[model samples]
Target: MKIVSSEGQFQGINHNRAMEPAHQPVYEMVTRTRTRTRTIAAGLVVANLALSGLLSKADNYNGNNTPPADGGYRAEACESAKQYHYEHAGFNAPGNTGGGNSRADVNTDTNWFRFPVNFQVHMLSTNKIGATTLYKAQMDQLDVTNSNNGAIMGLDPSTNSTGATAVQTNPAGWFIESFFNLNLRQSLDGGHTYTPQPTHVVLTNHNPPVFAMAPLLPPLGGRYGGETNSKIFFCTNFSSPCCTNGIIITNVIHTGFSTNFPPPPRGSNAVHTFSSTVSFNISMDNGLSFSAASAPAVVTVSVAHRTNDLFDPDTGRTTMVLDTEMTQLDISGGTLPAGVKLRQSPAMPSDGITTILSNGPSSYMISSSFNIMPELSLDNGSTWIPTCICKRMKHIPPPDYPSTCLSNAPLGFWRLNELSGTTAFNSGSLGPTANGTDTSIVQGDPGANLTGMGANNFAYSFNTTAFVDINSSSLNLNTVTVAAWVRIPTGFLSAIVSRGTNSWRLYIDNGGHAVFQTGQGGAAASTAPVDDAQWHMLAGVYTSSTFIEQIFVDGVLAGPISSATVPGNPTIHTQIGAAPDGSQARFFGDIAQVAVFNQALTAAQIQTLRTAAGGPPSSPTPVLTISPGLGTSFDITCFFGTTVQRTYSLSSSPNWTTIGSNASPYILTVTPTTNAAFFRLVR
Candidate 1:
C-alpha cells in the first residue's frame, strides 16, 4: 500500500515530497563499506548453493577486476523437465540470479509484474465441512478497473490433492512467476458469451518470470474420508545463464502442526506430515505439457542476496521502499555500495514493507507484518472463527485462536466482481448477500492489454441503473465505518454507500465533493471534488461514543472538521451505488471493495483500504543531518536510505556527479588544485 497523493488534490501535504511519514521511516547511511560494483571473474560458472547455514561462495567468482557484462539475463531452456533431486545437485547454475540491479528505468505498473508467488489459500471452515461438500476459497484481492500502476500479481496453482507433477504423474505442485502481454478474461453468461462479466483468468502468458516462492500450503483433504487433494508440492526450473535471473523463497509456511503429518489433526494441515515433500514438482518446459510425493530428501532453499537480479543490465542499484510497519531492516550486503538504497517511495503503502536481505545470492523478500494464527474463513474476508477452525477441530490451536486474527477481521466485505448475476456476492460472512436488482456488471478494466482485478484491484461498473441494497438490521451500527472505492465521471452525483437520510453516507453530494457525513445530526466533512472519472477510496468513521464524524480521502484526513455534536445510533438499510430506494441519482461509474465495519477503523486501517489503486506519484526529496567529523572524516544521518556522496572541488561551478564506489578510505592525491569542499546528500 503506497501513499497516493494526486498533486493539487491533497491539502497542505505535498504528494511530490517524500517526507518522514507518521510511520517514521529510518535509514542508516553507512556509506563507508564496500565498492558498489564487484567485477566477477569472466566466464559463466554455473554452481548451485545449499540452503540455510552459510551459503557457498564460488571460488574466484567475486573481485577479479573484470567488469561484468552489460547484457541483461535471458533464461535458459527449461533445464530438463525432470524434478530437482535433493540436498546438493550442482549442474552449472549461477551462484545468484546472475547480474546487477538498476532502478534507473523499470516498470512498476500493477499489470507489468507476473510474480510466481506460491501462496496459501484457506477456505474451508469447521462449521461448513460436515454433512456437505467442501467450501472453496474466495479472495477479494483480485478483480477491478483503472489500475494504472502496480504489479501483475498472481500465484501458481498447486495440487489440492491431485499430486500432479512433471514426472508424467498427478497433492499437486505449483510456482509463482511473472508474465508479459498477459490476458485476463471474463464472461457474462454462465460460462458462455464473451460479452464480459466476472471471474479473472490469466491466459496465454501462463508463465511469467518468477520473483519469489511464497509461504507453502497446508495439508489438504477432510478427516471423514472426504476429498483427495491431499499433500502439497512445488516445482521450479532454471533458465539459461543470463545477466539477470533470480527467485526468492520464504521459509516453510505450515507451523503449529504436530509434526508436518496426519492422525492428521482437526486442522488445515491434517493430511500430510511436515516431512512429506510430496509437492516439489516442476516442468522446466513450457508447462512440461503436463506433470508428486513423499518427503523426498529435497534441497532446502537457503537465504541468498539477490541484489544481482538487476531490472536493467547497464545499471546496478538496489532499492527498497519503506512501509508503515517497516522494522529496522539491516540489509546484509557488501555495505556502502553505490547502488544500494533503502529509500521511501512516492507510493508509500500504509500496509507494510517487503524485507530483502542483499548480502548473498538472490535477495529474499518477506512480508514484515506480524503473522496471524491460522484460522477459518467461511466467506472471503468477511468473518473469521478462531480456536481451531479447520476440520474435525476437537482442539488444535493449542489454547485458543490468537486475538490478532479476530481483531482485524471485517464484519462484511463485498468485492462486487460478479460475471453475470443479479446478486452481488458478499464475500463477507455478515448477513445474506445484498442483491442488485438491475443490469450492472462486475467487469471493469477489461481487455488483455489492460490491468485486471489484481487481487482486489478492480471494481463493479454500475454505469446503468443498478444498485445493491442490504437489510438495515443486518448492519445496524453502534460504532460505524464505511469504506468503498469510486470512479465517477464529471457531473456524477450519488452515494458509494448510504445509510439513509441524515445518517452516515460516503457519497458525492450535488456539490460534487467527496463527502463523509455521519451522526443522527448529519454532520459531514467534504473533501475536494473527485468527480473527474478517477478512482478514489472514501472512508467514513462515526463514533457514537465520541459524537464526531471523521472522514478520510485516499487515507489522508479530509478537510478540517467543525463538529456540531449530535448523539444517536445509525440505522436503516444500506444501498450501494445509489441512495436508499435505488432512485434519486445513482453513482454513474464503478464501485469496489465495499467494507462495512462495526468498529470505527483507525486512520492506519483506513490507509490500508486507500491503497486499492497505486501508481507512481511524485516523491519528495529526503532531508539529511550532517555533522563534520575529525579532520576530513564526515558523518551524515537521516531517516533515509540510499548512498550519501560528498564531492569536493577546487573550482566553483564545477560539474557535479555521483561518486563511484571504487575504493574505501577513498585515497585522494590532494593535489594543489583540490581546495574547495562542499557536501550535501542528493536523492
Candidate 2:
C-alpha cells in the first residue's frame, strides 16, 4: 500500500525533486529463479524490462528529461497504466515529479493506504528483519494478469478470541479488464492464514473502484442465539469501459459464519452495475452465505476531483487539467434494507476501519467521518435508534432473567444480591459500597405470575439500624430516578433511599403514602398507600430540566409535581434504606431490585422495571384484617398466592424475624409481647 503524509509527501519517494543526472538505467530487472513461485517474480521481470527499454531509448537515457510541452508524448506513452511512472519526462503522469501537464493533481500526501498484510510477531520486538507475505494481493507490473486489489478484512465477533473467523476482499485482475472477479477468503485463525472461497463474477468489463469489510453486529435475537455476521462493501464504476465513464455504484454483501447462523438457502447475491447507489446484502446465517443485494439507495454527491497544470516537454506548453479523485464512504449505522436490525454500541470514531485488535462482537466500536450518526438496531438492520453514553447508574434484576434494559447499555448495573464484600460491582466504572451492620440478605421476593411467581428472586432486608451507602462523590447525579421493590407492614415516616442533604429522598410518609421529596421543595405523593403489607414497585423521579418531581407505584404514575427549584448538588454520602444525615427516619422493610439512574427515567422505563420486579397483581388486592382472637392473642387473616411469607416485629424499632409461609389459605394467630408491634405479609 502507498503511504503518503498529509503534506503530500510520499513515505519513501521524494516528489518534485530532480532525478540524478547520471545515465544509469532507472528500472531493476528481476532474475527468474527456479523457485516454484509463479505469482509475482516472473510477471514483474518481463513487464519492467519491456517498459524500461522503450522509455530509456525515447528519453536518451538522461533520466532527467521533462514532459513535452505539447502533451503529444503523453497520448502515446500513457496507454498502458494510468498510475505508472516513467524514468524520463515528456509523458505527463498524475502527480509526477518531472514537469508535466497532468489531468489529476492528486494529493499524494493526504492519502494514506495500508496494505493487507500481517507482521511477524517475533520481528516486532527485535530489530531483525522477518519474512513478510501479502494478506491480500494487488496488481503491479510484476503480477500483471493474476493480481487482486481492494482487499479489506473483518472479524467475527462471536468467535474472535478462541478461534475467530476473518473475512477479506479478493478482487481479481486490473480495473481496466473487461470482466472482474469478486472473491473472498476465510481465515479460521484470525488473519494469520486464509482459505480462498469460491469466486463470483460481479461485473463484466467494469471497474470495482473500492472494497471494504465490516463485522455486522447481529440483531438481539441473533446475539441470543450465539450468531455473528459481517458485511463487505464495494464501489463499482458502471460507466462504459469501467473507471472512465459511468456512475459509481456501491453495494454490500453480508456473510454469517457463527455456529447458530440461520438455516441454509438464506438469500441471493446482488450484482448491480448501473447508476450511483448504496445498499447492503443481508445474511441470516453467520458468514456461511448472503442474500441477493438489496435495491440501491440513491445518495447524491459530486464525484471527487483534482486539478493540475501539466507541462508538455515536447511542446513546452502548459495546460490545466481535471481528474477524478477516488472517494470513500465510511458508514457506521445499524440501519439496513428489509427490516433487519443489528445491535450497535455508541459511535466510536476509530470503528470505521476495524483492525485485528478491535474486532469483537460486544466490544467493537464504530465511527464515521461524513457526519454519519452511528445507530444500533435490536432487530437485524431494519430500524435504527440513537443512543448516548450512560455514565452513572445501576440496574440489577434477578440473576436468571436477562434484563432488556441492561441490554440497551446502561451506565452501571449490579445485582446487589450477586455481590459479596463491601464493594458492589457496577457494570460500568463506579462501584458502590455496602456499609454498616444490621443488613442481611434474605430470600428474594417472588417473580410476577406471568413467568411463574418464584422464577427469579433475591432481596436485601434492612432493620432500623441497617442501610447500604454509596459515596456521593462516586455519583453526582442532577436529574435522577431511583426505583425498588419494597414491603413495609406498619410504617411511620421512613426513608427508603436518600442521597445528599435533602437532595433526594424516596420514602413512606407518616400517612403511608409513597413520597418523593427533592431539595427543590417539590414533593410528590402516590395516590395509593404503599405500606399496606405487600410487595410494591416504587420509583422516584427528579428532573432538573423540568424542575419536577414524580412518584410511581407499581408501574403507574402516582403523582407528578412541578417546582422551579432543583435539588442541591449531591456532594455527601448516598444511603439506601436510611437518611443521608444518619438522623431519624430509617427504613424498616424488605428491599429488592433497586436501580439508580443518572437521568430521570421515562414512564415506560419505570413500567418495565415494575414488570421485571413483579408485575401488578392480577386479582383484586387482598385486605389484611387483624382482630383479637382468643385470650391474649390476635388472629391475622389474608389471601395468599403461591408462597407469600408472613413476618412480624415485636417492638417499634426491633429486628424483624420471619414467622411462617404457606400456599393454602389459613388464619395465623400471633401472640404479641410488645405494646407497639407490627405484622406484615411479604412475597
Candidate 3:
C-alpha cells in the first residue's frame, strides 16, 4: 500500500508480510545441554563448599536467583521476532501560531503486528523517535528517538500484514514553512525498519497537524481497484505565515496501492521507486470534505474527572481544580460522504473524536470531545440520532453501605495486614490461618492505599518457603472467582493459589504468563506477562453455566478461554503462594487483597471489585476479637453476615481440622490435650 498527499510532495508504501527468522533446533538443544551442565557444576561446587562451612553468598541459589526446575530459559526467539530498531530523524520547531507559542507534547501510536504482539511508536517535539527507550526482557536498552514533531502513524487496517505509514512536519524550513513541509515514511516489515519517501506539501502554514487513516470498508466505497485503499484524514490549524490563525482545516486523502512495483532497496529513494496515486479534498469548513461535523452543542453524560493542582507561591498553598470529562462523543450533526456512517463511539474517554463506520453507505458514529453524546447517522448524515454505547452502573457498596449488596459478597478475604501477627485474618466470615514463617507483610501500592480499606495498606511477601493455608469446607464451590493484587519482581514458575488436591490452581509459569487451571480440563494461559514488577489485579473465574474458565489481568481478559469443569464439592484445603501439597515451587512476590467469591462474578462485578479495592480506603475496619470465655475456653466474636468456621490444635505446630460453622458470637471450648491449645476462625 502507498499513500501520497494531494500535491504529490509526501508519499508512503506498505510492504507485504515477511517471516521473521526462528532459532535452529540444534542451537536450542545445545544451549539447553550447556545450561544443564553449568547448573550441575554449580550445584556440586556449592555442595562441596557447604561441607567445608565456607559457602560463598554467590553460591547460594535456592532463593530468588534459583534456576527453573526444568532449566534456565530465555525468550530469545520471541523477543527477536518482536524487536525493532529505531532511529531519530531530527527535530523541527513549529512555526509561530497566532495563539502564542506551541508547546511540545509527546504523542504515541501503536499497531498490532498480531494480537498481543504489537509495537508502540512514540514521538516528541524534541525530534526523537521512540521517545521512551525500548528495553528488552533482559534489560538491554535499544537506541532510538523521535524522528519528527507533530508526527502521526497509521496501519493498513485491511490486511494482517505489517504495513504502516507515518507522517511528520518537515524540519527544512522549506516553502510554506513547517506546516506545508510534510514528510512521509513507510514500514513494510512490521515496523522493524522504515524507508523514507519524498516530502509532500499539503498547504502553506498549518499548525497542530493531526492525521488518522483507516481502510475503506465495502459500505464506504471501493478501494482503487485493489484490495487495499486507505482513506487518510489530516487536520491542522490554518494560517498564512503558519501559526497566525486557528481556523481548523482538514484534508481527506484517498490512497490507492499497486503491487506492480516492488519495494525499493533499503536506503533507496522511496518516492522515486514507489507506485501509487493519491486524491484528496481540502475542507476549511471543519471536516466537511470527508465527513460532516456534529452540531457543537449536544447533551452528554459525565463519565470521569481529571484533577489538577495550581500552586499559590504567595500563600504557600495549593488549590485543587477538577474538570468533568465526557465519556461519549457528541456527534449530533456528524456525517460522512456518500457511503460512510458512524457506528460506535470510542471505547475510552481519552480517545478524542472517535469515528466508526458501518457496512451501509452513509452510516457512521462520530464522537468529539465537546459533544454531549455520540451521534449516529444512518442515512449518510441526512439524519442524526443520539446513542449511548456504555451505560454507567451504580457504584458498589453505595455511599450508604446498604445491606442489599450481599449477593456479591466474597467468601474469603485477606487484608494481609502487617500489624497482625503471622496470621492473615479473613475480613469475611472465614477463620484465620497460620501464615508461613518465610512470609512477611510489607507496604502495598500507594495508589491502592485507600484509607479505610485495610488490605490495601499492606501486602504479603512470600519467599520460596512461604505459604498460607486455609482449611474450610465452604471453599468447595463449583462456580468460583479468585482474585488478588500482585506484584512479582522476577518471573518464576510458582502457584499463586492452589487447592491441596489440585482441583484448581492459579499460577505463573516460567514464561511469566498467568495461568488458570481446573483439574477437570486444560489450563488457560494469559497472552501477556504479569511479572513486570508492576501492581496488577489477577483473577481466575470458573462458571458452571458455561463450564468455561477465564483468566483476567488488570480487569481485562488476557487469554483464550478454556472448557473446564470445577469439582462440585472440592474438599481440599487452599494454599496461597505454594502448591496444595506444599511440595512444589512457591511464589516469591507480593500479594494483597486476596479474595474468593463463591459465585462466578460477571465482568462488571469483577471490575467493581477491583475499583473498590483500589479506591480510597473505607472507614473503621470491622475487628475480630477473641477473649477468655471461661477457664481453658475462649469466645471469638465478630460482626459478619456470612458463615464462619473454626480450627484448633493443642500445640504450636497444630494439626488443623475444620470445626462446625457458627455465628458471630460463637464460643469455643478448648480441652488441652497437650501443654497448650490454639484456635482461629475463617470465612
Clashes of each: 78, 44, 38
Q: Which stretches of candidate 1 lie over 4 Å from their true place?
A: 1-33, 40-407, 433-458, 520-526, 562-571, 581-584, 611-683
Write model 3 residue lDDT over 1-683, tens digit each, in one string. Answer: 01111111111111111011110000000001111222211111100001111111111111112344432211100011111111111112221111111111111111111111122222222222221111111101111222332222222333221111222222110111011111223454445665443221111100111111111111011121100111111112212112211112122122222222222222231221112232223233333334223222222232211122323222343322112233333322223334324322454331111112121222221111211122344466565443211111111121111111133677777656555466677756454542233244343334234322332366777777678777777777778888877788888888887774347778898989998877658778899898898777788998878888999886667899899866543566787888776645888888876777777787656544443333322122122333344676655433332233443544455576555344533334444455533344444
Best by TM-score: 1
Q: What is the C-alpha local distance difference test score of each model? A: 0.33, 0.36, 0.37
Q: For model 2, what is the alpha-carbon lDDT of residue 154?
A: 24
Q: Which 10-residue window in model 2 sums to the lowest lDDT?
A: 1-10
- After aligning candidate 2 to the native by TM-score, how far in Å is the CA of 27 from where it should be? 82
How far does residue 377 in candidate 3 sit from its true spot (Å)?
36
Scored against the true structure, residue 460 in model 2 reaches a CA lDDT of 61
Best by lDDT: 3
Regions of candidate 2 where Cα sits further than 4 Å from its true position: 1-334, 337-402, 407-414, 418-425, 432-456, 612-683
The ten-residue window of minimal lDDT in model 1 covers 162-171
Candidate 1 per-residue C-alpha lDDT over 434-480 given as tens digits, one digit per residue, 9 for 90 to 100: 43443455565421111112443446777646677776465656577
Reference-based lDDT, residue 597, model 1: 80
Residue 527's lDDT within candidate 2 is: 73
